[model samples]
Target: MRKWLVSVLLLCALPGLSGVCHGAGFKVSEQGAKAMGMGNAFAAQADDASALYFNPAGIAFLPGIQVSLGALGILVPQTDFHGTTPLSGTPPLDTGTAVVTEHSRRDIVIAPTLYASYALENLPLSFGLGVNATYPLSKSWDDSSVFRNQVQIASIKPINFQPTVAYRVDALNLGVAAGIDITYAMVSLQKSLYSPVIDPTAPAPPFGAYEVGSLGLNGTAIYMGYNLGLLWKPRRDLSFGLAYRSKITLDITGDANFLATTPTGMGAIGLSDSALFPYTRAHASSSASTSITLPDTLDLAIAWRPTDRITLEFDATRTGWSSFEKLEFHFDSPQFAAFNNQPDPRKWRDVWSYKFGAQYVVNPRLALRAGYSFDESPVPDQTVDPLLPDADRHSFSVGTGIGTTLGSVDLAYMWVHFVDRAVHNQEMTTLRGSNGVFKSDAYLLAANLNLKF
Candidate 1:
């Protein structure tokens, strides 16, 4: 039981780890509709209640009480892959002229956000609260696809709560703020496992290539971090903003369940050698734990108001993904020595994204916005895999805001095009497919409602 459990856990742990980390592929940058419309470049022009997310210091410049509620809808079309993966064998075998083509299951995910802030009448102080999903992912491939052993289904849901306090230095036209981020995350993953029997005389590719079982992992974790922001207005037409978010380390505990599938012609071996195939036609569950350090982020931006009715902002963001250099997991039972303390090398690198956005106030009742961004991928080619086929992206967005006596509504639409990725690396060539060309794109629609009193 201990040996079988070790095999099951090691086979699926690394990919499972990737499922939860907020890599460039998993990070959801569109937290507000107004900001989304402006290419997420509103850090310096944080004038709305969404400022709690873009730049908490902007809250100090706001008057009265403000609240904003919104949701981002993501539509991911089928991701296309064409390539070949090695078959299970002592000396890995290839598909041999039988190239494979597969598509990932389409997914539609919705992430919502809420923010509220209050400014003191006499004191240059403001307090705000925000709730949002900064990182959410849902990816799936066909259950019986060639990549099944790598990953079939992966999903992560996380909620972040932030409470912020801002102070304004009216003398210097400067504002600074600090906040705490409390995040709770849940992760689930499923993947197939190949047989351990290495028979070369089998009629098919090989005995080791046969599907023997599947593994499922479910876990939850809670962690904390902090953020700081500064905003300054040197002149009426120009403003500068800076924001920083600290890294968070999550210690996750979960249950690992394994289910075995008896293959034809192997029934005799399973019956005779129960020690080798302990869980054949049976189920086993065990406890598993792991820790991961999410990356930190820094943002700098400049906002210029060329005219009373026009606002333009340019922002650059850097993510310290290098912190995710490796992954380590621990098994609960002491007998599982084979699968303990073995670290998997990720070697991810830090990346940057550049964005520019513009908004034009057409009238007191309407505003038009447009923006564009170039986002870089942190996954090196050596570490890229089917679980998260990350690539650089070009995003385009457009939106509008409508105001009424009661409140205002903001709507935005964005299209993201991933630079098709072609990989010929040795990351997981033997066990998990990694040589392929991946193409993917997504569409996002965001809407936010704002009210002030």
Candidate 2:
């Protein structure tokens, strides 16, 4: 039977997406390039095709059919860890030795989106559609690192297809949208499974260590969710807006495989044993499944336009992170039951955030934007680990708009800095590869094209 005590612990790493969820808990806030450039404050002033995601209700005010295509590129985070905990057990090769390391991921992740909007002249109603990677993250690490058991590699990518409808009242615009998300998650990890080495000529109580191969988990799931929005224009220059996105329950199912070397790396060192996990070399595989919830959110925003050249915005967002309480995985085969078959607790609390932004129109063809945001972290220090590391954050952003002959283009860049997080948990004293101070910073670059037909 597989003893899942170990397996239960690693599932927490499965929801792992790189920096996609930065300030927020595992959710992407920037949907459209224009909204991103404006510090994601487009809820009340959603005048473009991207309104499909920012606020569908804005579609009712559009003049004709609109289409937009956009893409954002993110540089891998420079996350470094300084191990402050020490292992007090015997060591054959210092398997749990504390090592200071720099950022391991050296890849660039790209996020893309496509949107369309339509307003019927006689119906006073509008319809919109959007296609985008709602949550995008990726990372890779080396197996030889001392932190291998924590996380070697991970990737979480979720694509969303949303369709929306909106109705217009004299001063109020009401809208609702439905979405289908296809999420793909994968993880690779390496750790030592102690197989005691015995020697006849040595001490009565043998204390040498032999190592096995790495364990791997990969999964994919499709889920459903929805969003609602409302926009009210009290004056020609001022507007108020509210938006809500429902939480998603993802049922992840996939295969669990083992990756290791044969002939026992220990056998080459003269410690040939009768207890080397079967005869020569063995690699096991099994089926695994789990359930995870994506948090729900509520956003309130205000936008003010003064003198037609300057626009200012403020927003508040609350995320229901309490939905995430634990990480549990079930195995189809008894083989996994022998290694792992348990649940891990993660009592995350809800969080709130504030954002402010400004847009200045330099001319009819050019505009400039800047914004700032402060977001609280939902992951507590006691639960912080390499697999799921988090901390509060402050972000600064800048962007611009350019009008073209056939359409308009929006470009935005954001710099996110995570407040340094220090952890001192029970695992730090008990687990070999646990405990440390984590630091991270990220960059986002996006561009989009709007077409009117």
Candidate 3:
């Protein structure tokens, strides 16, 4: 019974572990509608209020006070999975014969952002503030699906507040900026626990595998980091930009709850014998803690304008996912002390993304934009799971800007297609689900209102 309890706790903690390590894949890059329309390649052409997030230094070139309010709506279709794993079936059923097809739940997620900047009239200095949701996720599977024990539901919501200052060297056509990033995150997960051993309550011998109970966890954390940006333009028609965001460590504290499905199964066994299974309580609760390191990111880009009506830009972004090397957890309750302070190695590697975007101004009140990007997956096959089935992806976007008397309204639409992934991980046991192929895709729509005062 103690062994089963340890297994349940470990499984319950995995959502928090994997969610932070692979957050780069789920990071909300579309903080501004203009940038999203340009495939997030606007670092060099950051001319509007949203520049506070893309390239803070650009604020130094602005004329007066500006504000931007925007929101991104994301819709992910159901992800398809097919294949079999070690724990796909009961004892009598062969793993190969238990092949099955499953689909993840369809969900929509919305992330909002706000940015305000002010440029002093007499000084070449600017101050700005930004609030946005940088990491947001909502994923789930059916209760009776093959992956029920692996992950039934997982949700992560994070908010970031940034205050920035930028100085411009007009003589050298250069601008430099720095900012602090204060982030708060909340996470929740739910999954079922499975017992590999035969059920003693069964009427016959060779009792089939069954579920012990369900486990739920809720956690919250707060962390701080910094970001820096540089923008240089040697000529009127060309510009270069560089941006860096530092890493942060989040120490999370939460509580776990267990609810048994039946009173006669393993729960009754432990209740019937207290001496041998003193720690095996059917409905148990405990306090838990864990820490994870979020990776840093670097962006480099260039923008060019061959004609007054047209502009083009290209950008490359690198994420230092290699920083996520290990994960550890602790339980404050004595019953779970046996499995505390164990470290697990995660060999995630660094990855890069390339983006290209173009903008054409047709008139004073109208503009059109289009962009494309290719992003690489950071999670290795060994660590991939239903909680985060990441893969290489391609994104395409288009948008329009409408100038109004008060300000401007920008609208963008993007489609992301993830490459199919096939996994044969060694981490699978009868407790976790089997290896399989996963295919996924998503659609995003964004709108922003920019006002100049």
> Model 1, residue 220: what's the lDDT?
89
* Backbone clash numbers for all candidates listed: 0, 13, 1
Return the lDDT, model 2, position 396: 90
Model-by-model lDDT, in order?
A: 0.80, 0.67, 0.79
lDDT of model 3 at position 252: 84
Model 1, 284-340: lDDT tens per residue? Answer: 566888888889999999999999999999999999999888877777754344567
Using lDDT, give the best candidate's number.
Answer: 1
Per-model TM-score, in order, reads 0.91, 0.86, 0.91
Task: Find the 10 residues in a row with the least total lDDT in model 3.
Answer: 266-275
lDDT for 42 (candidate 3) = 96
lDDT of 3 by residue, 1-453 (tens): 454445443643465445743423777778889988999889998888888888888888877899999999989546888887444665323333477888999999889989999999999999999999888888899987777777888888888899999999999999999999998888888987655443423334443345566778888888899999999999999999999999888888888776655442343234342224433446666797888888899999999999998999999999998888767788776656665776666678899999999999999899999999999988788767787788998999999999977789999999998899898772333445357799999899999999999
2 or 3, greater by lDDT: 3
Where model 2 places Cα greater than 4 Å from the true spot, the runs are 1-23, 85-99, 171-210, 260-279, 338-341, 426-433
